[model samples]
Target: MLFSESIRIAVTALLSNKLRSILTMLGIIIGVGAVIVMISIGMGVRQNVTNSIASLGSNMIIVTPGSTNQGGVRSAAGSSQKLKLDDADAIKKKIKNIDYVAPTVNSSYQIVNGNMNWNSSVYGVTPEYLNIRDLTVSSGSFVTQSDLNSRNRVAVIGTTVATNLFDAANPVGKNIRINNQPYKVIGVLESKGQSSMGTDQDDMVLIPLTTAQERLLGITYIKSINIQVSSADKIDMVQQQIEELLRQRHHLVGDKEDDFTVRNLTSLMETMTSTTTMLTLFLGSIAAISLLVGGIGIMNIMMVSVTERTREIGIRKALGATFRNIMMQFLIESIVIGVIGGLLGIACGISISLIISKFTQFNTVLTAAPTIISFAFSVGIGLFFGIYPARKAARLDPIEALRYE
Candidate 1:
């Protein structure tokens, strides 16, 4: 028989038993759908992490106070008052390949603007903080050197704070009280959206570091120092230089643990990427188990199909149908089931992924590569599982098969 005739026969046979065929294809459909959804979610999570790190700024490094040991009880990181504004200045002056340095201290405070009141983080920082964090003033002017020098009570507010306090107002040249001390709002920052950790990036205020240390918080030490490198290639070098400089300044001799921690964003990004990639692979693997189970279902169903059609097979063989033709017929039937099921699974997976992204916080990403691969894998599953049943049907002795009842 011709190949097309075999395919026609196979399709006819499946159509004759529509319900059984659909039930047999169900496993493949579910397996393929699950795989696509899992992969999409994994990729989405990885992308979110990458974007979150990128939002911190390009070619950036952060310095913070390390843990301290007093009376053999180690305090939490950043609890020691070691990082200072002077240290920030020293790093800016001494370190090469540096673009900007922003030393900052932050505390939560209840901000009052007349009858309206809101709680938000208030950060004390220099003008460079804006450039370092890739933030721009959307309204009015940012803090100037004059503001730092005079310890002015001027502030820059984020978009979230502006909305809560000013309510669609420009917020510039307005007065807001922090801890009962009235301060002028000099600027409003553009929205930065939310971070991977679900932090609202646009929900805080910025003020001059000197003003915060001298008047507001009354603390001399800064909580953290953010540095922006001039180029990507120089980030590691600059980080090393800053670490050595800090160690020397703090008088840390050999084998002594430093009082500060230096971290480059590049290393952090790499670590996060590797971790997320592994997570994605793990999720994909777990979902692939369903495909294996689906393949087993196909084999079992094909075995039963061959048994039910024993008399028909004997008739065809006695009527001069070759073994190759009988085998091809069965194989084509299984492959058709897989192909149709795979297509349906792809559509279902994409639809569900889109629905999840629309309804939940999770961001789902769909790409062509995974979809194509999954479809191909389903087809392979069909071929592999169909082999045993197809061979068994083709090898049946015509005389005995005719008497199978």
Candidate 2:
């Protein structure tokens, strides 16, 4: 028979058993859909985390005061001593890679103006802090060096803070009391979207670090330092230099541990990427298990099909159909089942992945590659399941098959 005739026969056979074909393909559809959905979610999560890190500025290094310990092991950075304002100046002057270093002090207080008192966090830092964080002032200038030197009680406030506190009033030059200490509003930072750290960027206040330290918090100890590296390539070298500088300044012996730790930009990105990829693979693998089960379902159905068509196979063979022709007929039937299932699986998978993307926090993005890959696998599953049944049919003795009522 012509190859086209064989295909037509195979298709006709499967169409006659619609319910069985659909049921057999069900596994493949669900498996492929789930794989796409889960993997897309994973990719989205990675993108979200990376964006969050990028928002903080890749060239920036955050120096926290306390050592973060894991289990019972204690790890420290530059100095065991509290980070101070003096350290910021030392880093700026000593380290060549360091473009600018700013010290920060934080306070939570009730800010009041014109019957509008909003309770929020207030940070005190130098003018350079705005540039380093890529923050902008819309209406007024940032608190200047003169402001820090004179210990002026001027402040820069966020948009939300401005709305809540000043309302329609021009906030610049207006005084607001923070922690019962009066401060002059010098500038307002344009709204920065919420950080990955979950802090609303537009809900805080900024002041000169010296003023905040001496007047409000009443503590000279700085909480953290923000260091800016001049170039991306210089991060590792600069980190090493900063670590060494801190170690020597803190009087650490050659064999002794340093109190400070220096972190780099790429490390943060790498950590986030690896973490996201692993989670995606883990989820995708779990989802792929269902595909295997679906394959088995296809195989079971094909076996049943072979048995049901025993008489027909015998009749064909007796009518001068060769063994190879019979085998091809059965094999084509199986491949058709697989190809159909694979196509349907791809469609179902894309729909599910898109639904997940629309409703979830993940940046679930679907690519053609995974779709094509998964569809191809579905076809493979059909052949894999169809093989045994086809072999059994081909090997059947025509007399015996004809006798199988």
Candidate 3:
């Protein structure tokens, strides 16, 4: 028989038992949809992370005090006061690719302005901190070098702090008391909603580093140093140069660990992206198990079909239908079922991803790769699982099949 005739017969068989065909495709539908949703969410998270990090600054690097081992107990990074203002100054002066270096000291205090009182984070930093952090002053001016030199009690408030303390009024030139020390508000920073870690980025206050050290915290050491390199391609070279410079300055010998840690955002981003990709693959694998189960359903139904059509197979064989023709008919039927299921699954998966994105906080991104892979895989499953049943049908002896009741 011709291939067209076989396909017509296969499609007719499926159309006659529409409900059973639909039921058999259920596994593929669910599996494909689940995989798409899972992968979309994973990709979305990775993209969000990348965007958040990029928004901080271009080619940014951070230096913090390293861990210290004391009596077999290791302290966390930044627990030591080894990172000082001198260290930040040295990096700024020595590093070749460095654009801006801002030493930071942080404290949490209750801020009061007239009748309003709000608790917020206070960061002590230099004028370069604004450029390093990609922050802009919406009103007034940032803390100047003169402020640091004179130890002036001046402050720059983030949007959240401004709103909480001054309401609709302009916060510039207002006095806000931090830890009972009155500091004049010099600027209000532009709003930055939140960081990738979910921390409120616009809830802090900025002041001169000297003021924070001498007047507020009474500590000479800084929390961390934020550095922006001139270009991303030169970050590795700059990081290495900074490390060696710090090691020499700290007087570290052979095999002796340095007192500070230097980290580049590029490496951090790559690590995070790899972790998320692995998670996406794992989720996709788990969802594929259902597709396998669906393939088994198709095979089982085909086996039962062979048994029901035993006498019909005998008649066709006796009428000169070749074994290849018999096999092709069954195989085409399974493939048809798979193709239809795959199309429906793609539609269902896209709709589900969109719905989840709209209704929840999760970000979902639907791309063409997953959809194409899923559809192709579903069809391949049909061919793989259909083989055994098709071969069994084709191998039936005409005389024995005709004897069945």
Candidate 4:
């Protein structure tokens, strides 16, 4: 028979057993759908983290006091008192690559503006904190050197805080109380949404580091040190130089343990990307097992089909059909089932990824490559599993098949 005639025959046979064909493709459908969903989530998570890191600035370097690791258990990033305000001042005075430095501290307290009250986090940093956090003020102005030097009890509020505390009223020059300590609002920072770590950035208060250390927390040790480099191109040199400087300052000799660690956000981001990508690939492979099961389902159904059509095959051979024609017809039928299932799987995967991106804050992108690969994989599965059944059907003896019926 011609190829078209063979296709017609194959399609007719598949249509005759629609319910069986659909049941057979179920495995492929589930497998492909699962693989797509897992990959989508993994990609979304990676993208979210990348965006969060980007918002923090590539030139930003975070310094926290403490040992990093020992015996697979890590101490807190900023648990020790090795990082002092003097170290921060030293870096500012000495480091050429460093453009800005801010010793940081934090506390959570109920902030009240007249009758309105809400609990919020208070960040203690110097005037240079804006450069370190990659922040800009939307109204009024940032904390200046004068404010820090004079230990001004002025605050820069986030957009959410701006809305909450002042309502429709302008927040500049207004007084807000943090744990009943009054601070004049000097500025309102632009909104930063939520970070990858799930912290709301638009709900904090900012105060001078000196005031926070003396009046509020009453501690000389800074929890963190934020530094802004002049340029990202100088990051590696800056990181190395800072490490060497800190080691020397901390009195580290030979293999003696250093008390401080410098965290380069760019390096951290690269590690996160590499780790997430590998994990996503692993998860994708695990999901591909379902596709294999689906392929097996096709083979199982094909085997059943060959058994049912034994008499028909014998009669067709008696009526002049060749073995090759029978094989092609059956193979085409199997492939068609796979193609249909694959298309459906692609559709389902795309829809799900879009829904995730829209409803949640993560970035779930459905690119063309994965969709094409998924469908192609489904079709390939059909070809790999269909050959055996097709060959077996083609090898059947006309005389034996005829006599058996």
Better structure of 2 and 4 per TM-score:
4
CA lDDT scores, all candidates in order: 0.91, 0.81, 0.89, 0.86
lDDT of 3 at 6: 85
The per-residue C-alpha lDDT of model 2 at residue 290 equals 88
Candidate 4 lDDT score at position 351: 83
Q: Which regions of candidate 3 fall more than 4 Å away from where they truly are?
A: 1-5
> Which portions of model 2 show Cα errors greater than 4 Å?
68-81, 166-170, 195-199
Point out the higher-scoring one by lDDT: 1 or 2. Answer: 1
Tell me which residue pairs clash in candidate 2: 44-363, 77-259, 77-260, 77-261, 78-259, 78-260, 78-261, 79-260
As for model 3, its CA RMSD to the true structure in angstroms is 2.0
Residue 315 in candidate 4 has what lDDT?
A: 86
Best by lDDT: 1
Q: How far is each candidate from the true structure, as Cα RMSD in Å?
A: 1.5, 2.8, 2.0, 2.3
How well is each residue in 46-120 modelled by candidate 3, as lDDT tens digits? 887887778768898989996766777777888888888999999988878888999998979999998899999
Residue 117 CA error for candidate 1 (Å)?
0.8
Listed in order, each prediction's TM-score against the native is 0.96, 0.90, 0.93, 0.93
What TM-score would candidate 1 get against the native?
A: 0.96
Q: Would you give me the overall lDDT of model 3?
A: 0.89
